[model samples]
Target: MKRLNILVTGGAGYLGSMISTKLIEIGHNVTVIDILEFNKTSLSHLFVKKGFKFIKADVRNKKLLKNLVKKKDIIIPLAALVGAPLCDKHPKKTKEINFDTIRYILSIIKPSQKMIYPNTNSGYGIGKKNNFCDEKSPLNPISLYGKTKVDAEKIILKHKNSVVFRLATVFGYSFRMRTDLLVNFLVNKAVVDGEIKLFEPHFRRNYIHVLDVANAFIFAIKNFSRMKGNIYNVGLSTANLTKLELAKLIKKYVSGTKIRIIKNRKDPDKRDYFVSNKKIEKLGFRPSVSIEDGIKELNYIYSNFNFKKNKNNY
Candidate 1:
């Protein structure tokens, strides 16, 4: 295997921190560029590794991005306004960071440099009952965050020697934890808040662990020749469940948790769909962590750390 210089734009983030650390452990030189909008301590563990580097900067800086893009063998663009509510609140910043920065990178990236993009399954919006959305499924994004990512996905698809992974809702513990995610959010509330109320309990969605998502990027890098220029849905086939089912699972871990369903309430996110992982799994990439296991892990983390005063860590 060839050792490469990889640049991760949001290396301090929930997903990026894990990917960067794993790449360094496997002997690749990983450089992370992040603005530290959340917790800055997430990637600090990577400092001991000689192959790791961190730069505190925004991805929207074109001059800085051009200079960095020229030096990297692979670029993983992970920085973005991640959730729908946050993106809606800051639409202007979302457009610049998510869409415009991608265009800048595409124009300046070298032909030999590989680009691995992280897209959301939210792009699928809603799926038909009992059906799975594959990479070929038509995207009908209903939120600002999903729309921006869909536009960015078009850029990656048009580029040669590039790959995109439309990941399902990610769970499990991370150095930079995000309670905003579906599984993590609900589980945290059940444990800390002592109960959780559901608006659309029957809404379905697929899930994958954080480390599994990191492994998908690594798998794509190792098999770039076979997977480049294609999009794959990265999700756990067995873990697709409705929101109500998810709450019940959490109730098992958090004792005395009450789950109440609110009738006729709509999910603001509006993304409720089951995703297929057959395409990526056929390429020898399989998710390792189960939702049950992730729940246990989060239960332990929350037990060890108090999230009440540190809500900004997300």
Candidate 2:
């Protein structure tokens, strides 16, 4: 793989921060642009690295983006109004960041520049039994967040040198601990309070480690010729597990953890579907971290860092 100038939008977020660090470690010059609306400390560790550059700005700024994009060889767009509840809280802002930001970047990204987009499996909306959704699956998004992902995907897929990653629910620890994410929240609760509250425990979904998701971006960027203009579901087939199943896995590591099943309940950010990850696997891309392993790792990270008890105090 050629040494390249990689630009990561939302680089301060969980997936982006880890991915940027990996790229820097591999001797790539990485520029991270983030709005810092949610948290600033996620990028704190990268501030002093010579190969890493942090730009505190929104992706919606067209002029700023146009000026910065000239030096970039590849762009990974991860900036968005991330979750359903957050999108619901700020609908217009979500649409602008999630959709319009793509429009702005697409206008500036050189025709020769390559790019990778991190989409969500939640965009699969719902799936039929015995029919795991692959890239060919119809997207029937159930939330504003999912809808925005679908919209951005349509705009990006038209590009000749772009790779779209419909990623599964990401687990594992980062500088940022988002309690809203399924696995992380469960692990945090189980480890800290010794119990996890459940809603729609039967809802099924796939999981992937944050490091693996970051590695997939690196893989896609390195193998861009073979991966270009393709949509790959980024995860492991074995990582697909239900909420109850996930809780049980956490219980194995965290002792004396109690589980409460809430009947007739639903999550505000509801999404349930088993995704097939055959395409990326065909490209020799396989996830190395398992959910059980992620739980153990996250428990260790939380024990040392304790992001939950010190939530937002950073």
Cα lDDT, model 2, residue 200: 89
Q: Each model's TM-score?
A: 0.96, 0.94
lDDT of 1 at 166: 91
Assess the local accuracy of residue 20 in candidate 2 as a C-alpha lDDT between 0 and 100: 87
The pairs that clash in candidate 1 are none
Local accuracy of candidate 2 as per-residue lDDT tens digits, 1-314 = 56799999888887888898889888899998997766668878777887788899888888888877888999888888888777888899899989998988887777899889998888564545554688999777888888999989999988898999988999888766576688888888887889998988977789999999989998987788999988999886897788999999899998889999988777654567777899899889989998889999978876667564434312
Q: Which candidate is the best by lDDT?
A: 1
TM-score for candidate 2, residues paired by index: 0.94
Give Cα distance to truth, residue 206, candidate 1, Å.
Answer: 0.2
Q: What lDDT score is found at residue 47 in candidate 2?
A: 75
lDDT values, one for every candidate: 0.87, 0.84
